[model samples]
Target: MRLAETVTFGGSDLDRCAAERKDAATLARNLAEGGQVIVLWRGKPLVAGDPAKGACRLVRLGAEDPILRDAEEGAIFLGRIEGQAIFAMDISGWTPPEPVDEAQIGAFLDPTVQLHPGAPEGSAFRELRAIMTTLTARDAELAATARALGNWHLSHGFCSRCGVASAMTEGGWQRLCPDCGAHHFPRTDPVVIMLITRGERVLLGRSPGWPEGMFSLLAGFVEPGETIEAAVRREVFEETAVRVGRVDYLANQPWPFPASLMIGCRGEAISEEIAIDPAEIEAARWVTRSELLQVFAGEHPEIRPARRGAIAHFLLENWLADRLD
Candidate 1:
């Protein structure tokens, strides 16, 4: 796990200026001088060129960029790099030029890309998952932060405590209810995705609605009082009836598919039998390391590997190369 930070969305080293967020004057000055502003639309980030190519990258706009005027909310400070401040803004209020299929939009890694008339030439808004692996470490974190924070503000417009509408404050990091003295912060649900192994085979499962032949490491949310180790064991047992004996943390990635922290773990399975709960997963099976190699290469006949940017894929890649230690 020494190279944990190398995982997508984990190694950005963003200098999130926590103290400056509270200083109104300093924040205003930074916004005035900050030239790096990443734009998102309906949870999709704006990128330039063909993201499938190595040369493609994010197009972080200046603070004065007119496209940012359509942002439904205020600018969010996403830290800095080399003395230049970076910000993220969601222009979800703007509509795309073409009529989009509501069903295909992120239903399964949304293949549809959108272009705005005012956006930069060759720039288009695309689902972050589609372009996450192609982005630099910095852009990956920026997109994750933007999507997660924007989703939080959109879904949490009301105070849970008093059922009152809240206002964005603290540089879009905190929400304050005017009626009550309630304050809310962004939420990141911790999910444990375990690589369960028995001898040379690893446990894999496909959810009920996943695309055909898709399988991934078993995963579930960490309950309120459960530890990481306990969550891994419980989730594996619950989903596949596989009892995990020992669990160790492997790495973590900021999965902003609506704000999640994917905690990758390695678990030694004491049992090989898989009795998948139909309600939890559509199918469960064991695959050998050799089979995994085929799956990663897109040569496997039945199963495709997890998405490239996912923690599951990262863990599997390292495990295959004997770099998990």
Candidate 2:
């Protein structure tokens, strides 16, 4: 899509100094010396400061009013943000005040806390994706990293093999079992999201409980040992009874809502039969490029365009502009 990479978290070529992961002390010292500055508040990063100018603040743990922390407990050296060294701190342990109702979460969801220290944060912090355009590329990548690693710790606290509690290791990337000596690493499940086209028309589906009129590309999790092409075809067929052929990988996005890597593809539909799988989807149909254009423009009577920032939207926008090829 012409605006594919323009989505939230689209990416800004942030330096992710992966080569320095092994040297924690040097990296931490480098960060304290004021080279990089971008911190995440519940996964939303603060991109407003100038680290090289020493305009950033690092709140010590247990300090009076600290909004962020080192995300890995150890430093994960994020490359420079406009020539400043960016380091992410994981503050996943902090909990917020009790909520009286849903509206309370609104105050808790503000993005400014990323810039300010301790404007009241929460334990359920996640990667900041909604306001991606306003964030720097360094901040976006750090937020994604924080969300992915934190989720791994949450879901894999217990070992699958021995049913024992696992300890964080490898700078929060791996979990080690003390009882059985088993090693576990963070997981990123693969999902196939495809724009299935049959000439001028494409396939779209709406899952149960989504907003009315909302439709998106057919998607499903890739089965174990399955190839990307196979997963695309299988998911499309199983959901809508549409046989897809000639799958071509288009793009990919790292979705850290508990960790998923969306594999975007363009698939050619061999048949146009509509047989919705009741358990998986509520409705499926072929939508012409013209109709999709209307939906994108918010003029369609029955179907709404996919949510912004989602891979489906990216694919559809590109397809409509004849850029998906």
Candidate 3:
């Protein structure tokens, strides 16, 4: 695999059985014959261990598990692993035993965990960001797939072309509008996250409402009629007024926080000066290579490295090691 493909949520090559999704008979056979099942709540995947500590992984359940009774809209076929058909279900309908921290549910990285009374021992629905790094490549891919697909179904129940409810077809891969014959597939918003470098320093910015000391590579959604290269330069300049000369694609990650594909890129910034747009970002600054090392080592007094398991952190680490090739 290429070094770029090693980024979290990228390397896994699970076999997504597209043809079988159309075969309802085959899908039923797989589930009846014991396919691997994954359960999700809201956007969180059911994980087995505490991610804050060591040794955490996604929890896979059997098809006949009682908790499947609470699954919303039945099962979603989430491709295959080796020879086993993997399926997922969003049991958002399942309520918890007690009250939950509503504030944390929508935070950037929700630290809160919810335990379902019907789930397996030690299994709880935890935020994917909170436990992404701890999951194996296959588990991470499955979790991301389940979260992205489930969320898409939640918001896109109605057809865009006609004002009518669309039914999920092709084993949850598509939504067909019964009224207008409009077929809508899952949506993955394309985003550009570029590492803008000027000499030995890298440009970093923090959003207005982000926690103190949290900074990452400048990113923005790719606008219509925009190429990846153009989007990279535009986002960097718009946020920091730093002009970028040459841009190259590096890696890509599937960020399932409301479904986005983060396209990682590296840009050579021609301007050293930073002019932050308050509306775009709260602060923008350049951090030296040496200072970045301190930030990663937790020795920097005022700066925090990008969150682990994110493409930004992966790109920065590779850059620091001189391995962005």
Candidate 4:
């Protein structure tokens, strides 16, 4: 897909200074010199303004900011933006003054516009997924990087090899285990999300607990020792008993709901018969181009289009418009 990277959260080419991450003294200096920080509370980013107008604001702070006093761990160096250093701090343990809104669509809620005890009054922790489509490319990339790296540090605090707790090192890029001398890096699980085509129809499936009428491309995690193409084929077969062939890579998106790399692909379906595995998916079906266009137009009563900002939606939209070249 020529315009593949134009997808939401796909195009920002931030200079992730990998080499600088290893220099503790430089990182400390950056912090001491008043580097800006992005704050994440319980995996939700602090937003400062309205998201509907394409200004999904990210709260940036300085090192001595009062909010950092209660940060759970040292800041993660997130690289430089326009010659200024960027960092991420997590204050997951801090209690919010207001109860979190549970009826929000995504994992976290857009906090009430009120003053927290120690934080800025206008800022509110909001789920990245809930506002991803509205954010600028830079904000989306930065938030995704922070959320992914932060989630890794939170979940992989223990060493997998020696069963020992690991300490954060290398500016939150690596973990060091004292007991086993093992070095652990942040993990990004690769998932294959493929659009399977048989003539004029594309395959889509719905999971068990998904909202009624919601469906998306068949996707599954890449198993160990499995190639991306192999994973795509395996996932399609496992979920819907649809045999896929001639797989081709399309585009990718950083899906930071607990850290995943969504590898988008297009696959040719050799067999049209769908024998859906009830355990893997609640339902599976193939829809024609016209029918999908209806779905996108909100005219299909039985199916809701894939959520915007997701790679699935991106792929399907491009495919419908014949732009997946």
- Cα deviation of 149 in candidate 4 (Å)? 0.7
Q: Candidate 4's C-alpha lDDT?
A: 0.87
Q: List the candidate 1 regions with Cα displacement exceeding 4 Å.
A: none
Scanning candidate 3 in windows of ten residues, the lowest lDDT window is 1-10
Sort by lDDT, best first: what order?
3, 1, 4, 2
Which model scores highest in TM-score?
Answer: 3
- Tens digits of per-residue lDDT, candidate 1, 216-276, equal 9999999998899999999999999999999999999989989999999999999988898
lDDT of 3 by residue, 1-325 (tens): 1487777888586899788899988897898798878898898999898676755788888888898888768678988877888998888888888787788887877888788887889888888887888988888899998999999998998999987999988999999999999999998999999999999999999997677898899999999999999999999988989999999999899999889999999999988888988999999899999999999998999998899899999999999999987
Predictions: Cα RMSD each: 1.3, 5.8, 1.3, 2.1
Cα lDDT of all candidates, in order?
Answer: 0.88, 0.67, 0.89, 0.87
Q: List the candidates' TM-scores in order.
A: 0.97, 0.78, 0.97, 0.94
Pick the winner on TM-score between candidates 3 and 4: 3
Question: What lDDT score is found at residue 317 in candidate 4?
Answer: 93
Model 2 residue 64 distance off true place after TM-score fit, in angstroms? 9.7
Return the lDDT, model 1, position 306. 89
lDDT, model 3: 0.89
